[model samples]
Structures are given as structure tokens and as C-alpha cells.
Target: MLADGLSLAKMNCFSRKLRRTAPELGSSKNELVPSKLPRINGWSWPLHGFQVVGWLVYIYLAIVSFGIYIPLLPPPWNHVVHALMGIIFILHFIAHIAALTIDPAEAGVRAKQSYSSPVPLFDRSKQSHVIQDLHCYLCNIRVGPKVKHCAACNKCVDGFDHHCKWLNTCVGGRNYWCFFVALTSATLGVLLLAIVILFIFIQHYLDPNCLRTAPQYAGIQGNTTWLVFLPLAPVKTSSAGLLIVAFGTLMLSITCLMMFAHLMAFHFYLFYKGISTYDHIKMRRSKESNIEAGKPPDVKTNNKAPKFLQT
Candidate 1:
């Protein structure tokens, strides 16, 4: 009877212990499994703060230049300038949209992993590179020679160029053309706007009448110079307003030109060299690493047309 009672007590204790450990065991099991890929809300502007800022800046500049400055010019010239700037802005907007929405992931990765699936965790300890033998560790799939895993996008991009923070996406094989168009349009637009602003500034001093040619400024009499913020309301021109607008336009033009011009020139150089931005960066890093390791860098010579320009 005592043995039976003791055995019952032991079984009850074991059941209680199993109940207590069950959740822990299950949690440990869960830990062993790979976690799902983070949901990348590409359409969410807030997710890409820089992208939002870029859009806002573009809108502000467009409004100030097209709405305010352009209208200050004479009839035909103002209309012509407005039309040209409008076309460039439209091209830029369309290209920007295309670059942002296109998926640049490797074909195999895109085919194998659905949006809902858990991407396999890459084991860096077991591999030297994210891709070895054309196989991606994280994606657990075969990829093309130019495929590279973008840490920012957390996906293997085919023909990876570079991740553009402005577009909040990777620029790769699919969207490279669109990105180039956007860059070109933006650069051109800013340059034209700067020229017009400079012309307007010179005209403001040399022949203020040319600037006030717009129909809205007809009511204001001589010596009481006025500047229009919005079309309907014209306020007497103040030194403060003139300085603010002039300085603001000048700063925006200079900053944007410096950035966009440099970027455009760099991309042109990359094309001339028959390399993508990723390749250039990787080569630079490799060279640096080799120098650090006290190893002489390999030298090779090739006299061939750039891949981009090849027939």
C-alpha cells in the first residue's frame, strides 16, 4: 500500500515537472527554427525617411520655381520655360516611381521565397562570403554571377548596382535605366532652374520691368516695388523677403547641382570602366583588404570596349 502511494506521488511530481518544462521546451524548439524575413514596407514613405525628404524638397522647389519665379517673366518666355520644366519634372516623377516599385531580387530567390516565407539565416561562421559557387547562403538558392546580397534591402539583387536611399530601393538590372533617367532629369531640372533664377536675379536689378511683366503686377505703381508670393496677393518688396528667396534658391541650386552632378559623373565613369557601382566598391574594398594583409595586389590589363557600350 505504501509502495503504491509513493509511486502515485512520484508520477504526480513527474507530470507537474513536465507541465512546467513544456513551454520552455517548445520555446527552445522555436529558437532552433529560422525567423521570418522582416516585412519591408516599401510603399511606406516613413520607412524611408530620406525618400520622404527628397519628395518634399522636390515639391517645394517645383512650387517656388514654377509657380512663383517663372510667372515673373514675360508672356511667351514664361510659358515656354514652364512647359520645358514641367516635362522634365514629369519624366523624373515617372522614373522615380518605377525605380521605387521594381523588385530587384535574384530570380531564384524571388521564385523560391514567397513574401510569407521565412528566409534562412546566413551562417557566417560556416561561409566566407554571402555567395559562394553562385549560391546565396541566406537565400539558400542559386544566383547569377553578378548577384549580390544587399544588407540594406536584405535580399540578393541580380546585377546589383547600388542601393539608392533616395528611392528607398536597390538599383539593379531591372530598375537601373529608370534610376539613370531619374538622376539625369533631376540634374537637368535643377540646372535649368538655377539658370532661370540667376537670370531673374540679374533682371531684378537691371530691368525690374521685365520681371514685373506678369499681368498680376500691373496694379502696383512706380517706386513701390512688390513681390508676389501667391498669384492673387502682392506685397511691397521687402529686403528680408528678397534676401530669403535669393539665398534660399541659390543654396538649393548649388547643393543639388554639386550632389547630382557628381553622382552623374561617377555613374558615367562607372559605365566607361565597364563596371557597376557595386563592383567598383567591392574592388576598392578588396584592394584595401589586400594592402592591409601585406599582400601585393594582382595587376591585369584589358583593352576592350566597355561592357555597356559593346555591340
Candidate 2:
């Protein structure tokens, strides 16, 4: 009936550790108390760097598009607009990285032993709601309700959400809000870039003179603009620059915007239903004992999340 090897304070925090470690139930349970584990490694950092570098290049080009490519354009498509877009992109970009790297507040893994459930005051004859909590063999601890054991991290995370390969970490109770905000900001930043690029293309077709990149071929500027690299018309340096902006900034911006939009919408529904993307994708039955059931501690029946998780 005792929590065995751990102290009172340590027992109090044991449930939290399940929400933080790798989820593998097969890991060695030697450590009695949870320790901070490394999130990024040499093998994973390269892929993470790829994501960082790709976004950096895209953001840089979106910012410079205003100053170099189409300065002669009219209001809304001018330096002011470009500067605004750049600022937005930078702000959201920073938010995304910050959320990605921040620890999702891992739980403390404390080994637990055979324990008897306490009786409630009003129902001394009958026990209050029991969540049917499971034992994490790998962590060598009994897991609490809604705490999902990650086999990959070989640790348990409370309010376990999806594993974001981009961040190279699991998104759970601690970082869900930040993850949502990052997706939102990144989407908007890229969308603004797309809008700006689209406007430039529209202006080019309507009045080529308005486009700085419009070809100056024999007093009759052809259909080539920043959006088009080479039409039936001769190629100019400005037009070539426009081509880069077209495929590079515009396409990438729209693609990123669409992806984040879908992600935000999906997560919004998850928030409304009070579930996580992990639950939706895997749809594991949490009622069983084994990890294959993907059993998370069932908090709704009895236990409640902590103050920080509620936030």
C-alpha cells in the first residue's frame, strides 16, 4: 500500500514524470527518480537545422522583396507593406522557434509499489471514481490518468500530445499553447508574403509600367513580370529577379500558409473536444492496462490537471 522507494514529496510528483519522458514502456526502469534527458542529438539536429535554415532563407527573401524587387509599385505594395510583412514574419518566426525548443515541462518519474485507493468522506461504503491507472514497466512506476508513456522518449508525459518531428520532441501539457500559437503566427507571416507577391503580379499585368521588374523591351513591355521568369518576351535582370520571387517566396509562402491553417483548424477542434492530436491520430483505447492500449491516466473520472496544465 506504500509508494515504496520514493519519499512523500517525490511520490507527489511521480505522475508528472510520465508526461515528460520517452514513451517506451520497454526501457530500463533502473532510475528511481526521473532525470532531465537530452532533447536534441547529433543525428536529429541536422534535420532540425534543415527546417531552421529553410525558414530563414524564405523569410529573408520575403523581407527583401519590397526593397529590391518592386519599389516603384504603388501604395499597399510599397516599402511600408513590405516592412510590415517582414516584421510579422520575424515576430511569428521567433515565436515558433521559442515554442519548439522550450521544454514541455516533463514529469518526474518516481517508482511506485502496490497501493490501495483511499476511501472518500461521503462514500465510506464505496470508493470514489477510480481511473484504472496503468503500470509503466519501462519506467518502473504506476502511471496516473491521462499520462501517456512515450516509448520513443522512454519516459511518461502527462497530457501527452503529438510528437512533433520538426521540434524533435513531444508536444504535451506544457507546450500545446505555445505550439498552437507558433503555428498561427507562422501561417499569418507566410500568408502576408503570398498576398504581397500576388498583388505585385496583378499590378504587372494591369500596367507593366507599375512593375519595377517589367521588361523594358523596345518600349512595349511584354507579359513578363516578377511572377513570370520567361514568357514569349526577352529576359531582363529584373524579370529574372521576379521569377525567383514567384517560385521562391510566393509558392513557399502559400504552401506554408495552407499547411499551418489546416493544422490550426485541426488543433482548434481538438481543443474544443478537450483532446489532443495524439489521441485523434492513434485513437488508442486507454481503458486497458498494456501500453498497446495507449493507456493514459483517465483524469476526467477523478483526477484533474494541475494549475499550469489548466493554463
Candidate 3:
């Protein structure tokens, strides 16, 4: 009984500290949850399955890079590019998984006051029934400013950004940096994979014997891709090289790699503007409001340039 009481006391003290220290999110309460805030959600079994697929793809990349491609190439292709790419990209992937588990901010909460309960006269605890400053209607806790209630997680997060279906978590506050790093590294890494695959596949054809046949058919060295893009001709189809090329490059090109590219570009624009995606939407709404009110919309085109040159 005594041990449980002590544990409860400690928890209460920690909760008090959080409430006392947490800052306000915004000037107004209603403005807390902006639209399209981080699609980032928390961990779940479904996300675990999603990330597993990414890992499988990465492992396949490694097999294609080291196990299949390098052996076919000359001494020049045996450099440390593959190793470096794996290290950097793997580190970022790990960072993303780690970031997903972290809470952007912790809100403070305490039990509601009960007037019928008598206070202990002998014990001089610092205070009684101290509630948090900002209360979350959803979470039933006091959250700091920038903290918004995540409907998916059913918790009020500090600096609640967005719920990411990929990570299955809300990417908020300091966690966003790691998430961005993950995106950048993953995108670049996939791009590197595409480049490497193209180089190796093209290099294979550079072998003079590749196209020149034994007088049965016309020799074709240059890309006959213009003839038709689909059902890639069985040129060297017997070689494992073709299979690896198709699997590692083509599969990723259509899926993870391409999606990462476009997603990175979108986030880059958001970061350059120094605003969250939600904030961009808010700006658009404000501009529309101005238009509706018959006010001349501020006509500054959001050109991507240095602040000094922008002026």
C-alpha cells in the first residue's frame, strides 16, 4: 500500500511540473488544430506491416547492388558507392522509425477536484487540485500551445503536426527533423539505386558482342525503346542481369522511389516557404477571404529566393 501511494505521489508531481512549464500554443484556443496538420499517426500493427515491406525492398536493393550487379562489372564499378548508400539510407530509415515512436510533446493532467473529499490537515503538500492551463476537449488534459488534439491517436500532442500513414504516427515538434532527414535520405538513396541500375544495364550492352548477332537478325545496339516501351524485348533475357535490373530498378521506380521523389519535392516546397502544409492551406484561405471581401489581395508572388533578393 505504501509503495503504490509513493508511486502515485511521484506521478502527480511530474504531471504538475508539465502543466506549470508547458507554454501556450496560440493566442486563441479555437485556432489550435489547423487543417491538414501532420498526417503523422502513431504506431500500430498495420504500420508495422507497411514498414516491413520497405525493409524488404531495401534488402532486395542490397542483393542487387552487391550480389548481382558488381560481379558482372569491371574493376571500376567495385567502389564504395553501394556501401555508402546503404549506410546513409539505412540510418535515415532507422531514424524515421525511432521518430515515429516519440511523442511530440507530453501534456499534463490531474484528477478533477472533489469538494466532498476532506484534505489532510497534518500533511503540508505544496498545493491541491492544480489543473493545467490549456485543456484539450478530446484528451481531457492540458496541452501546451502548438499542441493539438490528434483525433487518430486520441491524445493531445504538443506541436501536433500531421498523421503519417507511412510511419503510422504523428510527426510533430523535434520529431519532424528526423522525419525530414528520413525522407531526404530515402529519396536520394532510391535515386542512386535507379542511376546505378541504369549504368550497369547500359554497361552490359556496351559489350560489343551484345547486339551483333550470328547473321540471323539485324544488329541493334542503340536503344530500340522508341519502337515500343512495354514488354521489354528479350534482349539478353537469359541473363540473370536482366532479371535483377527489372526487379530492383523497375519495381522501385514505379513504387517507393517515384513516390518518395514527389513527396520530397512537395515537402521541400513546404520547408522553403517556412510553413507547415496546414499553414499553406491557411494562407490560401485568408487570400480567398480577402478576395471575397473586395479587398485587393496582397500581390506578392511567393517566389523561391533568398530573403534579401526577395525584397
Top-scoring candidate (TM-score): 1
TM-score of each: 0.78, 0.57, 0.58
TM-score, model 2 to reference: 0.57
RMSD of each: 7.7, 13.8, 14.7
Residue-level lDDT tens digits of model 2 in 93-120: 6766765665553354522311122111
Better of 1 and 3 by lDDT: 1
lDDT tens digits, residue span 15-39, model 3: 9998766435433323233222222
How does each model score on lDDT? 0.73, 0.54, 0.54
How many steric overlaps does candidate 1 have? 0
CA-RMSD of model 3: 14.7
User: Which sequence of candidate numbers ranks them by lDDT, best first?
Assistant: 1, 3, 2
lDDT score, candidate 1, position 49: 79
Could you give candidate 1's per-residue lDDT for residues 1-311 as a string of tens digits? 99999999999999998877543432321123344462232463346778888999899888877666887777798889889999999999998888888787877867776766666443333333556567766777788788877766667888889888888878999889999999999999999988888887888778878878766666778734657564666556764576478679878988999999999999999999999987787666666556776877553223322222211
TM-score of 3: 0.58
Report the C-alpha displacement of residue 152, candidate 2, in angstroms.
3.3
